[model samples]
Target: MVSPFEAGMFSGPWRSLLSLREDVHVEETAEGDLVLHGRWGDVLLRQPDPVVRGVLNRMSLGPISLSNAVSGHGGGAHGAAAVLRVLDRIEPLVVRTVGRSDGRLLVSVAPIAPAARLRPEPLPADRPIRLSRFAMVRTDGSGYILESPLSLHRATLHHPGAVRMIGMLARATTTAEALGDPPDDRLLVDALVLLTAAGLVVRGEHAAAPAEKATFAEDTDPALAAWSPLDLMFHTRSTLGRHDHDFGATYPLGTGRSPEPVVRPAADGPVIALDRPAWEEILGVDPPLSVAVEGRRTARRYTGEPVSLRELGELLYRTARVRSLVLRQDGEEPSASSRPYPSGGSSYELEIYMTTTGGRDLPGGVYHYDPLGHRLEVVSTDPAIVAELLENARTAADASGTAAVLLTMTARFRRVSWKYRGPAYALMLKNLGALTQTLYLVATAMGLSASPLGAGDVDTSARALGVDWRVESSLGELLIGRPGTSSGDTGRLPVNDAAWAERAAAYLGVKRGG
Candidate 1:
C-alpha cells in the first residue's frame, strides 16, 4: 500500500481541515464578551485572546487547513497551536472535511453528538478494514451520505469514488487493494481514514481486540445480536441520545396545512349510532379503581353467552370515546382531545375497528368505531375476512375458545407525526399500550375478558376495512369475550405477580386441571 505521505499530492485529509458551520456565528455581548451561537447551541467565550477572533473569522469564511492556521493569524507555529486550541474549545460548531489529491472534495464529516470532535488522520494504508455492520449509505441530493446509528458523526460523500470505496469495505479490504493502480488511490484511502475516525468503519481484525472485532460480527455480539437492521434504525431514529434528526413538536411540515382531523370522519357505511351511558351513570356505577386495576388478566375461554351491543358501547365509551375536541387556530397544534386513556402530545392517533362473531344485537363483520359519535361504521360484512380476522386474533392471543369480538387498532400516522417528530411512531405505540390497558380494566369492570394480541395483519385489516394501509395502518389487536367457567384461571389471582408465581410453583401438579 502506498503511504498517504509518500510523495503524493497534498490534496487529501492527511491532516484536519476545519470550518465553522454556516449557521454558527460569533456574537458580541453588551459586556464586550464574545459568544458563539448556532446549531450547536450557545457557547460564551470568556476573555478569548485576539488571535482566537482572527482564527474564527477566517474559519467562518470557509474551511481552513489546521496546519496552516498560523497563516490566518500571522503568528507561526505557536499561533497555529493556539488556533487549534480554540477549535478544540468550539469543536461542536466545527465541520471537518477531506479532499482528493486533485483538491476535489471527497468526504466531509460533521459532528452530531454534542461533544464529538473529529481527529482527522488517514488510516494506515496497509491495514485491512471493513464497514461497520451498522453503517448505512444513502443518496442525498446530488451526493451521498454514509452514516451509522452507532457513530456520533455523519459523513457526506462528495465523490462517487468515496461511495464506491465504502461499498468495497463490505468485507475487510486494505487500502492497497482499494488503491489498486493509483489513478485516484489517495482519495479512497483518505476517505477510509475519515470514516474510520468517525466510528463508521471497522478496523481490521489485526488492529482490533477480540471485544472490538466482535462488534463487526453482529450475531456474535451479545449487545447487538437481537436487534434487526430495520428495528435498530427505527429505535435510533425515533429517539434522542443516539440520533441527530429533528425531534419533538418541531412541526417540520410548516403548520400551514392543518393536521389530520381529530376524529376520523365517518367512513361511508351503515353507521350504528351507539347509545352510550351518561358520564354521571358511569361514575355512579362503575367498579372502584382498585378493583379494576388489581383484577384484570387474560382469559381465553368464552361462554356461549352473548355480549349486548349496549355492553360493547359501554366498553368503547369507557375506554376510547373522544370526550371533546379542541381546535387551535394558531396552528401550533391541531384538534386534540380528551379520552379515558392517555396519549403523547394529546395526539389520540389510535382508531378502533372491531370484528365480531355476531353479538345478539350486532352481526359478525368488520366495523370501525367512530369515537366522536359513539358508533360503529360497518366496514365489511364479508364472512371470510371477518372469520379470518377473529381466528387470527384467537391464535395470536393463544386462546382456545372462539373470540367474541376482535378490536383492531389502526393509527392515522400523520395525526401524530405532523405535530411530533422523532418519537412519533414510538409515542403512538405508547398510546396503544395506554388504550389497551384502558380496555383491560374496562372489561374487568364489566365482567368480560379482554385479550391484547401481540401482533396484527395490516394487509388483511386494510382489505377488510376498505382503507389504504399506508394512510391508516393496524398497530395492535385485542380479543374481547365473555368469560366462561372452563376458561384459564387467569384473573382469579389478584395482581400480586410474585406471590402468584410462588403459589403456582408449589401447587402445580397437585391440582386436577392445573
Candidate 2:
C-alpha cells in the first residue's frame, strides 16, 4: 500500500515536471515534454510556469510504490478503504481545491506541538548503529494503526511542502483512498534520495553505498592492515577508550529495557587453578598492583615455569568479577556496574577459560573458570588441544613447561547493545583489549610470563572448549606460562627501535617523542 507520506505528496498542486512514456516511438516524438515510463504507467509531466517549477523542484516525495501511483488514478475497483492501506504512514491534515483546479487536491500540513520536541531521549552519535521507532494512524478517523520509524515524527515538517506539489497531479481524497499501493524500489529509492537531499530525512550506514572515511586512526602494522578495516577501526577506538576511561556501556534496548540477568551456576569450581601455596601467595600479596601511567607498558618475557593456579585465580578475580553493589537516593536500588577491571558497560561479559599444559595443582585438560564460585570446572582431559593451543599462540613448544593457557571470551554484548545499538562490534573489541592488559599486568606482577596472542584458530579452539560461539569466538588470546629464553627465536628476528618507530609514525602520523 502507498504510505501516508506518499499520499500526502501526491495530494498536491505545485507542478509536474516529468511523466512516464511506454512506447519507444512515444519517447521519440515527445522530445520536449518529460515522459517517464515506469511499471505503473506512462506519466507525462507538462512544463509549468516559472513559479510552479520552483515549487515542484523544492517539493519532493520519493520513491514510493508503483501500486500507489496506479491507485491514485481514481479507479473504482477498490473502495477508499483499500487506498487507505497504502497511506498508512501519513497523519491527519486538510486539503483544498479552487474552482477551476477542482481535479487538484491541495493539502496543507498541520504544525506539530512544541512539547513533542521536548522529550530528551539519547540519540545515536556514531555511524553504523541506529535507534528508531514508528507508529500508525487510521483514515476513517478510525482504522487499523500502522508503525513507522520515530525519525518520521521529526521529519513531519516537510509534509506541507510535499502535499502542495502532489495535489496538482491527483484528485482530492482521503490518505488511504487517494493512493493505491506503496511505491516499489525504483520509486522508493529515487524519492528517498531526493528527500534526503532536501534535508527531510537522513539514513544510517547503508549496505548500498560505500563506507565513510575513518575517524579513528588505523593500525599501522601492515600484517594487520589487510584485516577487515571494520575490525581494525573497532580495535583502535577501543584501545583509545582504555587509555582514557575505566568503563563504557553497551545496552542494546536502552536502560529502560535492561533487565537483571538471572545468574545461575553454570559450573561449581574456582574460576582459577593453582597450587595451595602459590594461590595463597597470589591472594596474599601485600597489595595488588594498581594500573598506573608508568606501569602500563612493563610487560616481561616468561621463563617457562608453570604459572601457579592461585595466581590464575587472583587474575580472574581482579579483572572481571563484580566487586560491589550500589544504590541510588531515589529509594531505587541501582545495581553497581563496577568490575575488578573496567568494562564498556559494567558488563563483565568476558569469560576466562584455561587449557592446562603443566600446572602444579591442575591436570592437563580444559576448564571453565567459574568466577561466582572461584573454582575451575574441568571440561576436558585431552592433551592434543594443548598442542594445537601452542601452535596457535606460535608458542605451544615454548609454553609447554609454563603454567596453563588462559583464553578469554566476550559475551553479553547485548548489555551494550541495549544502548550503543550498532557499535557492539567495536565495543566488544575494546573490552578485549582492556581485559587482556589487565591479565597481562596481573601475570607480570606475580613473576609469571604474560603473552597476549592476537592470532589463533579461535572458532575451532572455542568448540573444543565446549563454549558457545558468542561467548568464545570473539576474543583476545592471552597465554600465561613460565618465562622462556629470550636468546632463542625471539632474538633470531632483528629487533630494532626503528620498526616500532615506523609503526608508531603510521599510527599517529608524528615523529617519536624525546
Top model number, TM-score:
1
Off by over 4 Å in 2: 1-61, 64-264, 268-303, 326-337, 395-403, 470-472, 488-514
Which RMSD values do the candidates have, in order?
Answer: 5.6, 18.1
Every candidate's lDDT: 0.74, 0.42
> Which residues of candidate 1, in runs, are more than 4 Å off?
1-16, 28-33, 46-51, 119-126, 181-184, 205-220, 278-285, 301-306, 327-334, 484-514
TM-score of 1: 0.84
Q: Candidate 1 overall Cα lDDT vs. reference?
A: 0.74
Q: Give Cα distance to truth, residue 499, candidate 1, Å.
A: 6.2
lDDT of 2 by residue, 1-514 (tens): 3333333334433321121111211231243443334322344545523332222222223222223343444433343343333223111111111111222222211212111111111112222111111122224332221112221122221233333323321221222222223322122223333333222233343322121322212223456456563454345434432111112453435557445341224664434443223446545542234422112232235445565666666666766555564555664755444666777656555666677675667677777766555567777777787666655664532344443565645455444555564446676677878877777665545444566665656586766776667533646667776555444324445555435533432332221110
lDDT of 1 by residue, 1-514 (tens): 3322122222334544567777788887777667888774788887766667676777788766654555656666566555656666777777777663235777888877686755645566556677887888888677788878878888888877777777787776666666664425555666677788788886664544322342344436789888776788888888887656779888877865436777777777588978777888777656566666655668767664667899889999888988777778875544678988999888888899988878668887888898888899988898999888888888888887776888889999988877788898999999999999989888876767778888888898888878799888999998888765553445664564646433432232232121
TM-scores for the candidates: 0.84, 0.46
In angstroms, give how far residue 250 of model 2 lies from its true place. Answer: 9.4
Q: Candidate 1: deviation at residue 142, Å?
A: 3.7
